[model samples]
Target: MSFATPPGWYPDAGAPGTERWWDGTAWTAHTRPPAVVQHEPVRQPYAPQSFGPPVPLPPARGGGRTRVLAITLSGLLVLGAATTAFLLLGPDDSGTRTAPAPTTSDPAPTAPATASASATPSGEGGPDGDPAVLVDQLNGITLAVPDGWEKAKNTPDDAPTIRTAVSYDCPGTAASFCYRGTVSTRTARAGRTDPKAVAEADITAAADRAYEEDILGQRTHGGITSHKVLKAEPVAVAGRTGYLVRWQVVTAKGPGGVVQSVAFPSEAGIGTPVIVRLAFDADRPELPVSLMDTITRSIRPIGDSATSGGVGASIGP
Candidate 1:
């Protein structure tokens, strides 16, 4: 290595560990070998040096996604707690309420006004006594039972029934043999507005379809059809409403041999009339039509109108 000193090169004191390279513009003694500071090429900031536009910032108040999720869960928990409290305090009303117990001091229900008034006992009617008179009083009205009739008690525990069966064998053609009585007061479902109308309807029914269509089929209608109205009166008895219909029923049993039908009285309740029903085969023309007439025509409202509102056996052919 021959030493050749250029004009601009000299021994370096400041750059002790470096070499000098000069292209002679001025005296160059020391030079830092182009300080190859080989730092990993300093990377520029990852942002555009000149931002073209500003970035929009996210909302800062409500919360981030995770905070929102936490809040929603908390709300649901509160709702569940409220629902549990309501269920704990709510009343159950799915069952029927029990009836209140009756107090011991409650007054006992008494018989109806008509019933109490019409509670007549059985007795004997005279030879001309129309047995159905008491039945009339029991039905819906009070009436005279032809001077000698008496009323008998009945069996059914509810309705008012009085049998006016004759104690003595009545003349087969007697008019007032029996006073079958029937009555119904205000119940869960029955009523009579114009008691007279109810009475008329009942009589028509008995003398017409109820008796004729049901048992007579074509039996001779004797009681009402044959009789002309003699008198009618309003009456009340035994807490019931009723009337008394009096008339003479003409019955013709044989040709030119008509027997004068006796006048008997019948009584029934307005709501339920004493209907006398009789049945006989078409061939049995000799049925006790008189008895039937007596039973039906005799029906009258027995005792009362202030408040409100029979049976048989087989005749061996």
Candidate 2:
């Protein structure tokens, strides 16, 4: 439905007692405290009554009439004061009341620049400090990493599935690292046409391979076990259609490992689709999956950065 009111401030439908901007087509992020409206009591001229024969009464003494007039005027004054007080202090017709002045503690997102910055998602907190913004010129993507997370030094140079990879390890962990998140721009094989299918296969293979190695290392006695794919579904990443793959180990002992990956193709001319994976021990709560999702969704392709469909075309299976 269209806005019946012209472009201006209106009570926010989502938040009562707050004003939101109606930008003709839609409500904008811009909002402010509601405006207060004060009503005043209107004074009407007092008309004197004429006592006719039907309402006959004895004539008043010299100052009796004056006293009566004085008392009547005083009562009118009191009534006027009461009406003014009610109008000033009583709740509005809707039972909602706005402050006398707009609150300034939380300013409105009226500035386009401020709104834009806020629109970009970032980690709530990072160990290194405030979340740091990292822009990958080579991959044409940008994301925010938690503070205190250190980037791994050994990024593979010859991994085919990963054109370039950047891994961040959380603080307070030894060489093995406790929690880790990685962003990689994947490159398909020389003749592979469907990157989505390749990505899916690569994701599955990675999970199986990782679990196999884990079992072989732990089970020197030759007991074989497998990892399980918890979920695999089509997802919209960075405006591009992609897939989110989640898998976990099936072991009775120790901390079960979990892997969450998001893979999608890049838009035309913006290299291949990238995949972001976050892995951690199920026992540790350090791994932030929501932050991982934010990083994956923040990716942007080289020339198609302005487009909302992420870094790639909107094609997925």
Highest TM-score: which candidate?
2
Q: What is the lDDT of every predicted structure here?
A: 0.30, 0.43
Q: Which tens-of-lDDT digit does each residue in 1-317 have in candidate 1?
A: 21112222222333443323222222222233222232222211111111222111222234375367568767977887666665665555864443433323336333222212213322312111333333332222332222222343543233333332333211223432222222222111133345455444444443332122223233333222354444345544232344534333333331211111111122321133332222221122343334333433333332222211111222211
Candidate 2: residue 268 lDDT (0-100): 29
lDDT of 2 by residue, 144-256 (tens): 44444544434434221211123333222223222233444444443444545656666655554333333223321122144777777888865678877777765343454
Q: Per-residue error at 122 for model 2, in Å?
A: 22
Off by over 4 Å in 2: 1-131, 156-183, 208-224, 251-253, 268-271, 302-317
- TM-scores of the models, in the given order? 0.25, 0.41
RMSD of 2: 26.3
